[model samples]
Target chain A: MTDRAPGPVRRIFTGPQRLAPHLAALSESSEYGRAIHNADPPPCDAPPWPEPHGGTPGTGLPRPDPQRSAGQALAVVRSGALTTVQDLGRYGHAHLGVPRSGALDPPALRLVNRLVGNPEGAAALETTLDGCAVRPRRAVTAAVAGAPCPVLVDGRPAPWGAPVRVPAGALLEVGRVVSGVRSYVAFGGGVAVEPVLGSRSTDLLSGLGPAPLREGTVLPLGPATGRAAPVDGVPTQAPPAELVLRIRLGPRDDWFTSAALRTLATRVYRVSAASNRIGLRTEGPPLERAVSAELPSEGMVTGAVQVPPDGRPLVFLADHPTTGGYPVVAVVAERDLPAAAQAAPGTPVRFVAVRHRSSG
Target chain B: MRALPVGDRALLVELADGEETAAFHAELLRRRAAGVLPPVREIVPAARTVLLDGLDDAASFAAGLDGWRAEAPDARVPDTVELPVRYDGPDLAEVAALWGVPAEEVARIHSAAEFRVAFCGFAPGFGYLTGLPARYAVPRRPTPRTAVPPGSVALAGPYTGVYPRSSPGGWQLIGTTDTVLWDPARVPAALLAPGTRVRFVATAAGR
Candidate 1:
């Protein structure tokens, strides 16, 4: 009699009982979910992420089929504190005074893009402390990563890090971050803004690419080339409770006194409210300088920790100028900058000087 | 010449003066164009220093610098841009007073000297040009203008520049030009990249 029962009725009774095993396998063998969680620390000698690929062809990495166009659009409902379209970044134009502006928390943006089956360098929306909301003209798969935050679709609770399908005209709201300072939102196809200098990133310093999102902004979407990843969940590193930055001292270290160097390494500092895309300013004891002469403007890297006359340290970020006049007493390691990007104003910061790896 | 370590992937090479900086920068550019330079991300020159960034091994590069010599840049003709300017700036009279000459003389003196882009900074496509003698250098405005019109020809310290766009600036404006100094749509966007030569030609349209 039980075997003869209709297949639909029998499956309903057994499906609930069989869910645990499927869930277990998902957590155990999900490749897309585990890749970032188990990834090794980037090599110290590796160039900063989103390396300048200006005028270069596509990354040649496997990408979703470009023929499948997702002719849809996203209407911004809430712009939040600050939201900008970003991709990996613009590179190779520093000689023209162009900054390599891109996502500050690149790993987060990359992960979100991956969840949506977009190229890791696909353009996405980077929101500040306050999250944003958008309504898609067509149903699409989307993912949000970076600062942990509550996500809502049409006012109903939704998963934050996993890809979720939003119905056409449904409101996808990224709530204020529960922690951390920024969040990333990616669609199956990236935002289709016109590229400037080989990137879609909005460089606040040089005023390149698209402008910051406005409430009524309408953004075009590229075609969705692939299906979203099958993972039910993604694990992300927790935002640092006490931001610890690894740094290498030099170039202009001789300008600072030995005590100043000690102060930088040992003293506790907090992120300043004045921080912006150009730099992460710190509020703490000023470093004393041995030489007071003005530094001739010189090329500045993304992670340079420059010291101004105020004696405070200003760590250059993605949107930093290609050249600066202030002496850079040290430079934060590139890998550490992702965490720095997520650090909110007033977060405690510690700069730890790491010795250069001697040639083996 | 001094090559100092900047973190793990960059070096700041300091030269004796602006001429030396230009010469060294030109040499680096020549090597890079010839594909003899090691892979590098950027070669940025400033007043007295050149920054080499994104090197595979900054230490090894710095070590190699001891054997390198910067030849006086080749005397080959450089890319030159001619900007026609109308001497009708609000500060033209003040600049004339500073030069101890008539307002008309200010335009003549400025238009006569040839200039070279020393460096680029402050904003994209904005070049710091050098050619005027140190005695002719002018001080920046005591208080910068909230908005300097685009294409305004200006001078401050040892550099002469044109506003690529309307932005806050302190340079003393001496004239105006219609030439676009920067346009992203154009290949090689900046009209005055470092080492490019420039000349200001007086337009017959205005005083």
Candidate 2:
């Protein structure tokens, strides 16, 4: 999906008003992270909005495929819960301020996508805490990823992270629980919806994309080859029941007292219930900054551990704003993004620092 | 003069040079030419200093910034951009109300002079427009609405900008123009780039 288009990729989006630049300046001054380009003409897996290919900004949750439009789309009906469209994220176009709001878990989402031959960054259903049951109006291929739940397709146990075939009117049910905050169900070919802002990922706060799925909402499906073959590059390493994420120090790291920076490297923290896609708030020893100035705003990036006036180091995540004013003491490596993406609330998180001596 | 940590990947650069901002900018430019600090993501220059981003970590990057402060650069400026605007906005009257002057007079003052686009941020395609006329300096709204429609011309606290899309914003709405400030399809979706000269020409329909 490299060099795809002016799609949704996580990058720094400059808002027209003073708030953006103000945040950018603060991000720089505080050593939070650089202003990544949300407007990455082509997409990468990084957040901000990482939807591959440009998306059409749909006003509401996309309607199900045309077959369901006759009366009501009935491929996958969530009996008691809400189902919303998700993708890896709307990649690129952050310069225009689009967010890479997509699947909370990238490896799982990509695993589901490859199992069904859908675009790796295609939009799927990111079902939260509870499970959803579907009544397929027609036959299609799909797979569930993350929060590994008990999914029954055609009344038989459906294997996870692998594609399964369903017949028309076949009831597909998911009821398994495992690690992670969200789960994704990608279909063969892919979820066919009007691409919005170069993504199908719904931005709850932005109001720029579609709404969540409700009862009777029919999802449109693009034609598929009917193959459930698992594609390569999908990480098969099971998500650790517990996780520890490694990180690097910040650019302007001197804001913190030397002892505080040392504490960060040696600390072992756990994700608080308050953590979400926006940021990871940890319950650990608070590090005191050297100076307490109401700093100006500056650029912010994913995995930036920004400590606000309260002194708690808030690790910015996928949906974090393009910029902020808090001083960041560290950043997670690009290679470890998947680990950060799969971090659920209450998950154990430790920051291991790696020093880069490169002058370039 | 002073150096600080901006983020994990950048350094807040201040230079000992009287032209501190330019000196840091020159050093960055030289390094870019020399391909030494490849991780420097964004380098924004101000009157006295520049902010650098894209450092691998905060500690080592800060060390480099400190060295630059001591070794100042001989001076040069980067290219600046120029932007065009139509002065007619819905809040023009409200803004003039604060000044106790006629709305048309405010327009005259706004278009009569030029302003610099200090930075690009807040939303994609949105520019942080600083350098407002002294009389027009106003604070932000006490309570911000949950949603402000896109293209709504707004001003707050000595700054003026347009909402690119519907979003949670605090700026007071002035007037709106049909300019597509951000279109991902365009080469440079952002209508206003940094360091651009701007002039607002009154338009009948935009009003």
- lDDT against the true structure, per candidate, is 0.79, 0.58
Give DockQ for candidates 1 onward, in order. 0.39, 0.20
RMSD of each: 15.1, 9.9
Off by over 4 Å in 1: A1-71, A358-360
Model 2 / residue A247 / CA error / Å: 1.6
Worst 10-residue lDDT window, candidate 1 chain B:
B138-147
**How good is the docking of model 1, by CAPRI class?**
acceptable
Please give, for residues B1-207, the per-residue lDDT of candidate 1 as tens digits: 988777778888999999999999989989989999999988889889999989998888888888897676698897789999998888899889998899999889999999999888777788888998778888778767767888999988778888887766778899999998877767668899999999999997865
Chain A only, candidate 1, TM-score: 0.81
- When just chain B is superposed on the true chain B, each candidate scores a TM-score of 0.97, 0.71
